[model samples]
Each structure stands twice: as structure tokens, then as C-alpha cells.
Target chain A: MTANTPPKALAFDVFGTVVDWRTSIAALVGQVLSAVGRPDIDAFAFTDDWRMRYLIGMRDFGQTGRGFVKLDILHREMLDALLVDMQLDLAEADRHTLVMGWHRLEPWPDSVEGLNRLKRRFPLVTCSNGHIALLVNMARHAGLPWDAILGAEVAQAYKPAPAAYQRTAQALDIAPGELCLVAAHHGDLFAARAAGLQTAFIHRPLEYGGAPAPDLQFQQPWDYEAGSLTELAERMGC
Target chain B: MTANTPPKALAFDVFGTVVDWRTSIAALVGQVLSAVGRPDIDAFAFTDDWRMRYLIGMRDFGQTGRGFVKLDILHREMLDALLVDMQLDLAEADRHTLVMGWHRLEPWPDSVEGLNRLKRRFPLVTCSNGHIALLVNMARHAGLPWDAILGAEVAQAYKPAPAAYQRTAQALDIAPGELCLVAAHHGDLFAARAAGLQTAFIHRPLEYGGAPAPDLQFQQPWDYEAGSLTELAERMGC
Candidate 1:
């Protein structure tokens, strides 16, 4: 967090940080819906609802002392509830396909190039709440060049939980200050900073895809701030 | 595993399978010894002794309910005992340098190219007894392009424990048969077979530095056997 001392490793927050979950999920869901005879349900609205429940479910689960469940399982539970509310009866395989959509989200356009650039300088790891398998699948699907995957699943805690930030540093065998969390969400940045991790804010204004929530606004000063990952790479001297 | 069925993912045993650890550790230790005025110590013998205790310590720790300790801590413990046995007192930094040698071990000559070739076809993950930080550092040092790092550390159980192999399969969301254990040691491959996972063997003859202990020899019927990782890649049709 100090000016002269640079972070030895950079931890990334995926989903809205590296990948475009909103548009990718909306498109993938519509295709699945078309195949499954449920094209009437709005894909974008469904994506919004699913995305909205993410942090709340994870936090509440941890708060209620439910020890670390993978986000994939949580997503499936949420999807099943939504399906029940809509009076939808889906095949098991179709339900699985819908849930597996999280594993195949597309990265932001600048993600691949920017990550490659930063990887050349510092070790790049995933600090997202997305579990290791989902992160790995998304990286392969999106061509994101992550050096290592560590975060919620590895730490057994979701972001904003101090354990998510601290345990990641422990996993990497680095001091919290030596690991920088690069995230589009202000809350994640705030949590990282509070956990003694260096913080970098990435502006992803369209993360909600014109839905007007403004998920990536720069709310406060961070160690570094940039409009895109490429800009972050440039600012970090990578 | 059935011959007709191909594994969905490849999990690698890193130390001897992917890296020339004996040579690397011997060289690194020799350098440290020479720098610390203990040039008379036998580096190869030291490396061999240190490596010889690896599996025993891991197995005993688990059986004795020590839980899953990271291999780095184990490595440090082994190095300290070896130091005491030799009556060699080293500076804290020099002692750390010797243990960190694991993180900088060189891969076999054929490893990088073969891994790059195989990585194109399968998601290559580490199934080594080494922990995540050790694996990540080694991968970076050796230029191994691993999709994810898992194994004893991630599973919190050493190899030969069914939990190690089963947990890795579960983490990838694949059936046990869909995961292949690619290792040089017969014991490791045998355990994988027992755990309902596929197995492949790659020869690494000089793993112990030619002190009359043979390694990397083709021993038995495996799902696949090859002279090198490149050959393994070819056998897998990668």
C-alpha cells in the first residue's frame, strides 16, 4: 500500500472484474432457453436476479456458519428456486447446463492482453469468489492467462470476508501488503484495503450492461485506478 | 481405467515426474554450501536423504492426525534436521535459501515442450505432494503452463490417500475415471489405480543422480507408458 513498495503478486477479482458476466450469461441463457422451450423468460433479467443474489448468498451462508460451499452449488440452488417461482420444470441436464453457464463466461475484451502483460511482471492470481474449477474453465474459455488460481474456494470464504483476503496471502506465502487486489467493485477494494492488501480499482462502468446500476464506479482513492486492465498494466509499469 | 475411455483431465506429480529435482536440489544446495564455507558436504547424498523422507513424513503426519501441512514447512523441517545431523550451523537466510530450492527446481529437458503440447489438449494440473505456493513458484520458475494447481495441498491429503485423488476429481467436477494420474513412480500410479483413477507413467531414469538407484524405468502395465512426457503427449494423441 506504500508508494515506493510495489506488490509482489496481483490477485484478480473475476466475474465483473475480468469477465463480462452480464452479457455473456444473458446470451448463453437465451440460447439454452431457446433449446429448452422456455424462450419467454427474459435472459438479462434472469442474469440480473442471479447476479444480485451472489454476494448475499455467500455472505449469509458464511454468516450462518455453513462452511464453504462452492459458488457453483450456490448458483444451482438459486436457479432451482427461481425455476420453482416461475412454475418451470426443467430436465436435470438442462438445469445443469444453466448452472454451468458460470464456468464459461467470456472475459472483457482487454482482459487477455492486459493479464498477459501483467503476468510478465508479477505473478497473477484469481482472487474472485468463483471457485477454482469455475475460474479455470472460464480462463480456458476466455483465453485469460492467469498464473495461479486462488481465492474463495481455496480460502473457503467469500470476498469482503477478511479470511478471503488474508488466507489468499497465506496461501501465496506473502504478507497481505505484498498482494494487491485488482477489482472493479469498490466494496472488494475496500475490503482488500481493510485486510492490509494493496488495492487497485478497475472501472467497469458497463459491467451491468446498460442496466444502470454502475457497479464499477470509482468511489474513493485506491493505490491505483484505471479505466481498463490494460490501463492498470500501464500504470503498474508492467 | 477402461482402455477405450480417455481421461477428461491430467493431474501431474511434479517433483520427479515433471522436474529434475535431484539435480536441481543438489546444485542449489552445493551452491549454498560452497557460499557458506561447507563445500565439503555431499550435495547429491543430501538431496537424496532429504527426498527419501518426503513420503514417509507426509504419510506419518496424516496417519498421526497432524492434518495437511504444506510441503514447504515440511521441507524446512527436513532441512533443519539434516543440518543438525551434519552439525552445520547456517544463517537463517542461507537455511531458507536451501529450502526454497524446491521452488526453483529445473524441469526435465522434455518437460516444457511436452507440457505445452499436452496443455493444448487437456487441462494440465499439478497432482504433486507439493503445496500450492510451492507448485506455483515451481511452475513459474520452470515455465510450466499449468491450468490449475491441486494435489496433496488442495485435497489436504498426500498421494496414496484415496482422498487426494478423489478430491482432485471432485474439484474438477469429473468422474474418477475422467482424471488421469501422470506420474513417474509406480507407487503413485498404483495408488491412482486403486482409487478408481486412470494412470500414465513417464520414465525419468536420472531422478536420483545415478547413485545405483534406478528410476524412470518402465515397470508395469499402465493405461499409458512412455519414455518422456513428450512421448506421453503423443500417446494421448495430443
Candidate 2:
């Protein structure tokens, strides 16, 4: 690409796209539930429940106009509810540690290498539902190099909401069309595209907590599609 | 520090600490004035003048109920005013490139390596007055590997305001005492310390446009004081 054709920036969806949130959360839930002698707790279901709460929290924040609530706070709130629903109670210390699972998500195999390659040419950022601290710690833990972290918390709105993508584009000083959202989830890509951001759909295939059904189907037209970040990086000529 | 000793995330004050704004702005001014056929214009004074307008912009944003404005937009406004005051006429394209100097700041000589070392152990983030886009572009251009970008822009409040530091600490899900503000400027460190954040003074004696000045001094007790981020990294056992 010519110099003027170079992308000004690349923003990522962190949870499943950059970091393997499902596997990470599943592993943590398995270890914890096993330790508590509740080995049959359906770790995947519990993980899904926790994430569902995060989504509900964002929707509530939007409806109530309570301003932005960081992911950590929302995670803690959701974790408490999840524990109650699961009929598990733990000490405050244990609860705090469990709530921190969001900070220790594992990166997908190609995330670091792909982001590093992309960063050689374009600024790379995270536009996740995760709060700033959680994303920062996750980067430190996973060794993912990000130029900056943007989130629904920054916009006081979450994905599927136009403001989330718009706020990120605004923060990057790029027109919505100039910056592309690289995500594994079709819903996220659709939302980003709807907000006028170009979209790159990378197939994660196993994002839905490893459910039997495949998760890698494109729902709409996106600017790019790749099998993985590695493919995306190669296609970007990085 | 023991593992139980909570990690103290290092939040940096970006503008003059990580970026050599004076040099960057001086160079931009020299280029703009030269292009306009006045090679001997006081670019240094012009830089300071433009910076004064930036400060006014911040104050106005803070005093009014207006949200935080991105540094680029604020800079453009101030740049226009500065050009009018200097009685210079310039093409919009040239003015655009000149304002983009903020995106091309040079990292201090020891910055990248120092930050790299710190990144090996501690989370390194930007706690800047610069807008998120400005900081992100500066980091990308200067090879500053920030784990995340935190700013008054996110909090809608400027530095020295308690909300700026507190919002950062909250975002990180770390207590104020568990986060440290590292900077060459005493005011930033003082504000951080006052807001209950640990402080670290990194001496950048030449931050103010290379003019001769009094020896840099530290007024408050910081958790650590070091000459550079490399030294700070070593101190933190990175």
C-alpha cells in the first residue's frame, strides 16, 4: 500500500479475539469449582453466566444513565450474582481473586505476534468491554502489546451501541471509515460496521466457551475476513 | 517486593515526561515559519505561546460543564489564534501538518528502553493530560510501549484535579496507594501524591525547551526517586 493508503490505526476486540477469554475463564472456573468440591458445576455454563451478567450490566448502565461503570466493578457485581445463582459462597478474599479472572485471560496463540507485526505500521489499540485496569493488567499478564486501551467504559456504552465504536474513533482522531475493528465475533463486527467503522472478522471458531456448534460464521459484509490474526497481519502486508 | 505486595502500576504523566514536546513543537514551528518565509521567527516563544493557549483551553473545559476536548482539536484552535496573533497567513494543509507535531514527538533518549524494562515487571500506562489519540499516536510514533493509555480525556477532568488521578486508580481496580505516578514535573507528582497515589520523581532537567534553569528539585516524599525509568526498573527489581 502507498503511504497515504496506510491505516492510521487498528483497534481490537480484546476478550475472545486478542485473549482467549472462554478458555481462561473455563480453566479458572474448573479449578475453583473443583477445589470447592463442586466438580460438576458446568464450568462453561458458569463462565457464560458471568459474561452474561457483564452484558446485562452494560445494558443497565445504558438504560439508567448512571454514567460509565468500569468492567472490574461490573464483574464483581456480576460475580456476586453468579455465585448466588450457583449456590456458592466464598470468603471476601476468594471472591476478589475470582473477580480478577478478567485480568488474567490468556492470549490467543497469534495475538502477540500479529499485533507486534501490525504495530510496525499502524497504531494498535483495544476497544473492549473490559475496563481500563483489567485490560492493562491483561496486557501485562498476556504480554500483548497495545498502544492504548479504549473501552465501553470510556464511552459510557458498550458494543452494539454505536457510541462505543464512535467514541473509540473519536479518541483516535480518525474518521470511522479510516479505522477498522478487528474482532472474532460477528455481532461486534456488525455493530462496528453499523457505526461506519470498517470491520475485519477473524474466525475464532471456538469463542463460545467451546460449545459443540461452530462460532465462526460471518453475518454481514466486512472490510476483511481472515482465519486468524496471523492471516490478517499477512493480508495487511505486515 | 513479595507477591503479596500488590503491584504498583506506574501511571506516567505523558506530555513532557515521555515526549519531548518542546523540541517537537520548536521543530514544527521552525518548519512552518520557514515555509512561510520567516526563518528567524522565535519558534521557541511561539511554542510557549501556543502551550499557554492549550492551558487556557483546559481551564475553560474544566470550568464549564463541557467535556474534555481532544488535544488535537484544542491545539488547532490555539494554532489558529497564534497564527492570527503573529499576523501570519497559512494554508490549511500546512496548518494541519504543523498541528500534527504532537503525534510525532520524540521519546526522551532513555525512555523506550527504560519503559521496556519496567514493562517486564510492572504495568506501565499513560496518565496524561493529552487526549487519548494524541498519546496513542505519540506512543506509536515514538515506540513507547504503553500497556494502556489513561487520561483526563477519559475522566473529563484535567490533571492536578483529584478526579484525574482517582479515576485512573479506579479504572485499574487498584487502590490509590497501589498506583504510582511517575513524572519529571513536580506538579504532576504532587497532585498524584495528594490524591493518595504513590509518587516517583524522574528527573528531566531539560524539559523546558533546553533553556538554562535551576537544578530540578523534589518537594515531597515519593516511594521511589530515580534518574531514569531504567533505574526505576532496577529499583523495582524488574
Candidate 3:
């Protein structure tokens, strides 16, 4: 298929695009802090620190020969480090609760209904950094209707690496151009475009929660751009 | 934790367990034969030949040093060789139609509703030899509500190989015994059990059409046995 063959499938970037990870994660941290008798800790700052480690971990691990670690493992690893760095003490069960809380994330209000609309027209699969088990549990918990959960673990590489995008397209048996990457971050779409995938920008302004989301602004010439997933459904004629 | 924990997810075997490929492929072969003015071809025998080659292909491809190949490509490859062996001259379009027909398979009458019921109780996934694309298309075509599609392509090994079942359990973040494999074939269930998975035997009496399915007899010690997908749901308390 040529570059203009209307994408046969929509590969989604799940973390911040489809779900309110910042708010959900902050809530988890806040709960843990309160339970541990240290409620004064800034939950958003802790979440941001953990997310920063996660991003850096994915970048370094994907580029190295570390050979595919699941995002759940990385998340727990980051959680452990942050606990030490922040000088917090907790029982093993609470620590486990904090790390596994990712599986209980809530969807952005418009994500589910809009995705339901989009699914009527396109096969919806995740091309997220989250591994299959995490995505499956999140889908079950958040009522996200993913046709398939695929990405980093299956591709053996994380996003922003060309293999991550190219391999996802290959998995769906479609030309890169025939599989559109629907992602919130500009860096993700840039890498997808570089890998010859069509790009659709879905704005998730509150992804960072009270911090400037520099990537949330519309980048020029994306195949489609919408403020909410519901708007994306309207734009896609779903 | 232990061998007795209830399964966290249900991984299904698609081919003869969820859909009647013998009947479906025979119908496709009959159409192609009629379209080529060779209606005398025994479509059932032809389908059996194609299936035999397919089974051999998967067995060899999975165990060999040959890198991962998607089932779609393998299906097309087998279709090409079968046409040559049968001395049939089908146009490229007709050849494509026959191979791609696997994506459009008709589910057994009980599959959709029963799977829907099961999905409410467990995260449903496919552990078929079919690749993600094939399973995604088949689910869309047949209304199979799979939360994830994973198998040969993702695991890089086919069923009866230890890696297939072991890797699926790992991908789900569950112990091998925590993933119940629901399949019709004893070889598949036996391998799964060997890999420490719980097994649910599904009886597809008409899978072989007019031929006897020797493995259809009750093999003792399966975790559960049911006559149909609906019955499996009932037995699983879905």
C-alpha cells in the first residue's frame, strides 16, 4: 500500500493519551503516603519523579541490549528507587500496592466512548509501552475496549525507537503507512512518522498535572488532530 | 501462588475449538474449484491436505532455527503449494481470496455469546497459532471479544512447544497454573499441562467432518471438560 492508503488500523499510545495516569498515579501516591503516616509528601512531585525515571528507563533500556523488560517490572523498579530516594518507609504490601496501582488506572472521560465510536470504523490495538498484562488489567479495570494489547513487550523495544513503530505495523500485517499511530506526545508521533507511519495527534493537556505539557500543542501537518478523543471520533467520521 | 490458584485469565485455542475451519475452508475450496470450472475437486479432501501441510509448516517453522514468521504468510505459502500440488490454475485474486478466508471464518454458533459471558468473568485472550493480525481480523469478522491476541508470533513458538504456553503465562504476569488453556486438541492440552498450565478440554465433535477424531475421547485429569463453548462457560461458572 502507498502512503495514502487510508490506515487499515489505529495503533494507540495508551499511557497518558487514553488514561489519566498523572491524576490516577498521584492519587495512589497520596493514599500510600497517608496510610504510611506521611501525608505531607507532594504526591504529584513523587509521581513526576517516578514517571521521569520510567521515561529514562525506557529510553536507556530500549537502546541497550537489555532485551525486553516488561513495563510492569520497570514501573516497580522505579517505584522502589523513588521510595528510597524520597526516604519513605513502608511495609512490603503497601509498596506492592503502590506499584501495582497502575493496573487500576481510570480512563479519561472521553476515551472509552470515543474509542467505541472509532472501533466501529477501525481495528483498535494498543501500541503502548505498557506490557500485555498491565494493559489487560487496565482494560478490565477501566473498561477500555482494546482489540489487542501490543507494543514494547511484543516488539522488544520501547517507543521513540523506530523498531517499536515498525514492529507494531509489522505485527498487524500492514504497511507502516497503513497503520496510523494515535498518540498524545509529539516525540512519539515524530518517531512514528519517521518510521513511515501515519500520525494522529490526540491532545492530553492534563497529562502532567499542573505542569506545562510542551508536547500537548498541535504540531504542524499531522494527519489528524483533535482536542479530545471524542473530537477525534468526529474527525475520523466514526 | 500454588498449583491450586484459580486461573486469572482464559486463553483460548481458536482453530477447531472456537471455529469450524474444516467446514469453512471446504466451502472456500468448493467456491474456488467451481470458479475455476473444476467443481469435481473433493473440497473436504483438498481442505484436509491444505490443513495437513499447514500443521507441518507450523511444527517445523516453530521448532526450527527459522526466525518468526506470521501465520498469515504461512497460510498463503501453504495455499500456493497446495494449488500447485492439486494442479489448479487460480488467478492471483482467487488465490488471495482462499488464503485470506481464514480471517473471515465463521465462529461456532456458541462461541460469541459464550465468550462474551466468559469475558465478563476473566480477561479473555487467544493463544492460537494465528498471529495478532489474523486473530484481530477474525475477532472483528466473527465478533470474538478478545481482550488481547497473542500466540505464535508473540511467543515465537507454536503450541506443543513448551515456550508457547510458558511465554503466554509470563505475558499475563500469572503463574503457569494460573492461566487455564481451553483447547479441543489433546496434544495442545497435554503440552499445556506439561508446561504447568491448567487445562480445560473442549469437545468439538464435528471438527473432522466425516472422519473420526480419535483424541475426542475423554482424557482423564483435565481441570474441566465441556461439550461446547457455552458449556465451558457454564462449567467455569461464568
Off-target runs (Cα >4 Å) in candidate 2 are A1-7, A52-67, A209-218, B1-7, B52-66, B209-223
After superposing candidate 1, which stretches have Cα over 4 Å from the reference? A1-4, A36-41, A214-218, B1-4, B211-219
Worst 10 residues of 3 chain B by lDDT: B212-221
For residues B130-154, could you state the per-residue lDDT of candidate 3 as single tens digits?
A: 8888899999999999988977788
Over A85-110, each residue of candidate 3 has an lDDT whose tens digit, in order, gives 87787788987888798999999999
Q: Which digits, one per residue and each the tens of the lDDT, describe model 1 over residues B45-68?
A: 888888877756765665677778
Q: Model 1: per-residue lDDT, tens digit, A1-238? A: 2374899999999989899999988998898888888899999988888777776676466567777777888899898888787787888998888889889988888999999989989999999888888888888889887878889888888878999999999888899999999998887888898999998988888888755553345367888989899998999898
Worst 10 residues of 1 chain A by lDDT: A210-219
- CA lDDT of each candidate? 0.85, 0.80, 0.86
Candidate 1: residue B150 lDDT (0-100):
85
Q: Count the backbone clashes (under 3 Å) in each candidate.
A: 1, 0, 0
Compared with the true structure, model 1 gives a TM-score of: 0.93
State the lDDT at B62 in candidate 3.
50
Every candidate's fraction of true contacts kept comes to 0.57, 1.00, 0.93
lDDT of 2: 0.80
